[model samples]
Target: MDDPIYDIELEDCPICRGAGLIQDEQGWSVSVACMDCGAETAHAEYRTPEERLEAARRVALLWNMGKVVHTGMSD
Candidate 1:
């Protein structure tokens, strides 16, 4: 679980370089955390309750059939 955030960042994810996923050793496959903000190729940090709610709303809209599809999604 993530704590609420305030500041929103548009920076590249250092972990995935804003790719929103990590690739396999052979680069044949990739997977997303499906929880982190950067999974959308953009990230938001909600430090406050309001911001957290906003983030949650955004997350809710990302679901397809109640399942998150984060891999290969980029801005």
Candidate 2:
């Protein structure tokens, strides 16, 4: 049987805290990719509304720049 997707915790962007973007005191910022988590997305993929919203927020903040993490289920 396939394991639960959000078991324990979802593979979300750590840097952006699932928001997907980060800013510095110097008025500079950048977006990150959930690419680090390939297992979750590669195998049993699931997209909850809250998750999508979080992903969207991160992408939005990037304005289509940088990698917006593609996190997935993993250890």
Would you estimate the TM-scores of all the predictions? 0.29, 0.24
Which residue segments of model 1 deviate by more than 4 Å? 1-44, 65-67, 70-75
The regions of model 2 sitting more than 4 angstroms off are 1-46, 64-75
Whole-model Cα lDDT of every candidate shown, in order: 0.36, 0.34
C-alpha RMSD by candidate, in order: 13.4, 14.1
Candidate 2: tens digits of C-alpha lDDT, residues 11-61: 345433343222211222222334344311211111564553454345444
Q: In model 1, what lDDT does residue 22 have?
A: 25
How much does candidate 1 score in TM-score? 0.29
For 1-75, candidate 1 gives per-residue lDDT tens digits of: 343321222233434443223212122222223344434322334555565556544543333123343454474
